[model samples]
Target: MRPQRRKTMGSMKKASVLLLLFLSLLLIASEEMVAVEGRTCESASSRFKGTCVRSSNCASVCQGEGFPDGRCEGLRRRCMCRKPC
Candidate 1:
């Protein structure tokens, strides 16, 4: 009976560890998806142009056109057009 109890405890521990790992992976995946979404929104050619453009204020010259915003204030700034929601 003692050995059986030990086996059960070990299995439980393994299950707990697996659950933690799964949760961690899920979190990481979610974060990555958010980042991708942000990048897509911030892209100049995004279908949604106003939303990304509103979040940042910078001046930029894109394809010979100039845009002024806070993002333009930063060095190495690039122009991105966002669509408003």
Candidate 2:
């Protein structure tokens, strides 16, 4: 009975160590992803016509203008294009 209890305790310790190792790996992976994420820069859309009303419309127009993303921003509601810098 004592030998069986010792075996169980040894397995439990191994399991706990494995769990900690897995969690540390996950944390490191998340940090790498965050580091890979870069800053985005924005500029006024050159091809967008008229006042920007909907962000979806602005995005489409900005795409046509060769930008990755767009949005209606600022007090004037101008279509602003965005791309990673």
Candidate 3:
């Protein structure tokens, strides 16, 4: 009976250790995800001429204007440039 009790205690300790390890791994993964993600901000393109048409065209003009990307947005269909803020 005493030997069986000891075995159960040992198994419980191993289970606790595994649980702690899994929790720590999850915490580290979450922190890395948060670090990788960022808020994106947008502004109307200064160099884009006329009303926005194709998204590809807007993106090209925004690239020349030093932004990472762009899109035609809103009812006015303006070329909006975007980047991490």
Overall local distance difference test of candidate 2: 0.93
Rank order (by lDDT, best first): 3, 2, 1
For candidate 2, write residues 1-85 as lDDT tens digits: 3789889999999999999999999998878443577899999999999999999999999899899999999999999999999
- Comparing 1 and 3 by TM-score, which wins? 3
Q: Rate the local accuracy (lDDT) of all candidates.
A: 0.47, 0.93, 0.93
- Write down the TM-score for model 2: 0.59
Clashes of 2: 0
Give the range of the ten consecutive residues with the poorest summed lDDT in model 1. 65-74
Q: Write the per-residue lDDT of candidate 1 for residues 1-84, one digit (tens) a residue.
A: 378988999999999999999999999887844333422223353222243343333223232232232232124334454322
lDDT of 2 at 51: 93
Tell me which residue pairs clash in candidate 3. none
All candidates: TM-score: 0.37, 0.59, 0.57
Give one digit per residue, the lDDT tens place, for model 3 in 1-85: 3789889999999999999999999998878443577899999999998999899999999999999899999999999999999
